[model samples]
Target: MPTEPYRIAYYTDEQGNKPFREWLQGLRDQIAAVRIRARLTRVKAGNFGPVRNVGEGVVELKIDHGPGYRVYYAIDAGTIILLLCGGHKRTQQRDVEIAQRFWKNHQEQRK
Candidate 1:
């Protein structure tokens, strides 16, 4: 079980505007089922980078939904925060690097 609650976050992109919303709604429901089965609680939010550090009680999890979609999240304090959700590929190191840099900037901003 998680020691703290979880929070969710969203990433905004042209591809995610409307379709992502609907997709996320379904994903949320799936997550709820996962939570119940896993015996944990989950929450969702937006702004991926900031919450990574802000929600100290959470842990991050990434999911590859499909060819052009990846989901990032943090689970802590008994809650799960959805950090990023968009289309890309594992082979695209650049995208990962960008996200890392963004997250790093977020860390610096806190100080």
Candidate 2:
């Protein structure tokens, strides 16, 4: 029997806006954006994307080429991938900080 694919979700801010979507829209590299979308879709379709731990319970989805893009996410309940934020190598530090905050908020809301 085939197992169900993990559900993927984006973090929404207090104002009801999905920050991931906003960040995606603001991406200057269309190719990188396309690749990111493809990776996300593949993950939702049961394929695991390339990622690494970035502390604070956040995982960095590595995107090769063109400034080295990345999507910061958190795995929850072994069934959900929560995308907290996105950024490239230059912004990794700041992005990770934001991702941690988002993940913390998400956990709090679940309680």
Candidate 3:
């Protein structure tokens, strides 16, 4: 177990856009948004069930809710999950690509 629970933060771009939050609101159903947020809450509490690394330091979070929902994020500073973006299984390929770019830009800005 981790010594302390992780903190959840949405990765903001140079233009101050939060992809994850935008994705959440774009969902058709409010319930779906709630479900996704619940999962994020678990992540904040250090309860990530199982995650898959998807390159460029991004990890995939799977939600069995509907249409095989998925979230892309990266662990930073030992205790922060930086949410990059999200998409379902169908859009996964594209989602990963976007996340990679976002992660790279984020790292560059931090430097």
Best by TM-score: 3
Q: After superposition, how far is residue 78 of candidate 2 from its true place, in Å?
A: 1.9
lDDT of 3 by residue, 20-46 (tens): 989988999677688889988888887
Q: How many residue pairs clash in all the candidates, one count each?
A: 25, 0, 0
As a TM-score, model 1 comes out at 0.38
Candidate-wise lDDT, in order = 0.38, 0.87, 0.88
Q: Which residues of candidate 3, in runs, are more than 4 Å off? A: 1-4
TM-score of 2: 0.89
Question: Considering lDDT, where higher is better, how would the candidates rank from best to worst?
Answer: 3, 2, 1
Lowest lDDT block of 10, candidate 1: 50-59
RMSD of each: 9.1, 1.9, 2.3
TM-score to native of every candidate shown: 0.38, 0.89, 0.92
Whole-model alpha-carbon lDDT for candidate 2: 0.87
Of candidate 2, the 10-residue stretch with the lowest lDDT total is 42-51
Winning model by lDDT: 3
lDDT of 2 by residue, 14-95 (tens): 7888888899899888888899998988877767666789898998988896988889888888888888889889998999
lDDT of 1 at 80: 38
